[model samples]
Target chain A: MSHMEFTGKTVRDAIAKACEELEVDEALLDVEVLEESARGFLGLVGHRNARVRVRKRDVLKEVLEVERPDSRYTNIKPQEFSEIESFSKSGLEDGKITQEGALSENIDKSEIVSQAKEFLEGILCRIPVEAAVEVSVVNGSIELEITGDRSGLLIGKRGQTLDALQYILNKSINRETPLEEKTEIIVDTEDYRRRKQEILRDMALRMSQKAKKSLMPAALNPMPANERRIIHMILSEDKEVYTKSYGEGPLRRIIVYPRKAMPNKRRRR
Target chain B: MKELVEFIAKSLVDYPDEVNVSEKETEIGLILELNVAQSDLGRIIGKHGRTAKAIRTVLNSASTKRKQKVSLEIIE
Candidate 1:
């Protein structure tokens, strides 16, 4: 057993110094200040006193473990395969899922869930956007909730981009999952995709009306490939108007051009 | 044993460019340091670290071939 104490001007300084001396991850340890740094007279001499307790041996053991591996095990931890198997069986005991159920039957549910989450996160991180994507396991399916501006880029038209992501995640998980386990996965972004479709339809009507009034072509801002497709599909029936998608790749957008004279893009019930 | 673990770790991380592996020789076995980009550290570790454990599982299986013990750590 071991302990230590220190006095400093502030808790932050004391903790930082302790971390420097400890040579361990700061997150792993806890810190507390017993008293405030005393500023006596003209802030010249008195300082705060604090206490720090460290798991020196445990931490040292971890460092040494990282520094050197136990040669006897040859760097492998003894695995209890039967224990994992039993855990899987318990999930099936509820009868909601079977041991033979799709991919879930043969694999560890927790393990597969984790892989799916990480794999999806990687895809989102690559996209340069302020929005965030969160993955959840709901009813044995993967649900991706996206929050940000221009979320249509992620959902795509008819959920194509979302589909592609699901396909990629499925492939990655299977490759990593043990051979004996089978787990099926799905991904969705809340109701963002559905709501976007409605909004696009409304936009199409508004643009057609403007074109009819102005009797000149109007161009909307650039959108992702999927959303652009939706705009085109929505306006295809308007005899008085036409739609075109410009730009390239993911940034491409739709432009709705109205005929020289028309009442308006009719409201479709 | 060390080389194989490093190869897999590198492949699993999005920032493969940032993957680094160090081997420590011990009296009983060996310790492996798997460091990756702070941004990519989560991907390697996975949600709740399930993916990280899976990677360790693969490393363990490979280690079995050489009759040795091995463990993996994710350095942020």
Candidate 2:
């Protein structure tokens, strides 16, 4: 993530400059107001400009490796498919398949898939982009994939656009469905979710090593809550370091600290 | 308090003139009912009601000074 500081007559002015220079919407950038402007002597002498630091929220550039073909699911044995099918069929007959029927008695997997597809189509129509949505159910999760020439636009920078779409879809679904029965809904384009996860896992490993070596905390750029959770999960089992999220609201960042640097006891007052 | 909700709703929606805010006093507190143009409903509520939550947060802070409880309702 590229961060820059800007000074202006007011905090809003500095944010405006950052947005203009970065060529991104104000809402997309994570902004920190460092200092408020000060006026003295009739707003002419002894005046200080407000300062702010702004950066793109998700700066995965350094961590993102060259795009590679996803092969995680390619190694499944052909003979196991029949066994899994029979297992699922029996599970469904017994009404023990929560993934397909958890949300609501009246709502089914096909209904959720169609509703998701329709929602995505509505967004695409507003964007005036031509694309075909392919829906698939894998292990009870609904996956909506957009495949077309203009699908790149939907992915946005570092898949932020796709994340926003998924967030909205999940929120709408949860609002309509009971909390205990809700299932995961993933929206993606060009296998972005899987690819991003691989990259994030790699980044987490590298950052933890750096934290251990330097004995100093390593703070990552702000990311969506789900991505932050991925980083936390990746390092949860490590004994040498621990991850903590800091900051407020949407600008929260994940920091990895060496275990040795942690304070062992609280100081008495 | 009603004017505050109205002002925020008007600023967020495209149809500012159609935004209407009404207050109802109840036994527990004040209820501010916000009505916006049908098309601009999403803008006021925001994605997953985050905007509405933010608006309520600000209203709570403002109401604290007057020692009154205020709740917001985005009426369809």
Instruction: List TM-score per model, in order.
Output: 0.30, 0.48
Candidate 1 lDDT by residue in tens digits, A25-61: 7685655555656657676665435444433344533
Report the TM-score of candidate 1, chain A only: 0.33
Candidate lDDT (C-alpha), each: 0.57, 0.69
Task: List, in order, the clash count of every candidate structure.
Answer: 23, 0
Model 2 residue A236 CA deviation in Å: 1.5
Best by TM-score: 2
For candidate 1, the per-residue lDDT at A131 reads 58
RMSD of 2: 21.0
Error of 2 at A2 (Å): 31
Candidate 1: segments with Cα more than 4 A from true spot: A1-186, A249-251, A260-269, B1-76
Q: What share of the true interface contacts does candidate 2 keep?
A: 0.00
Displacement of residue B73 (Cα, Å) in model 2 is 20
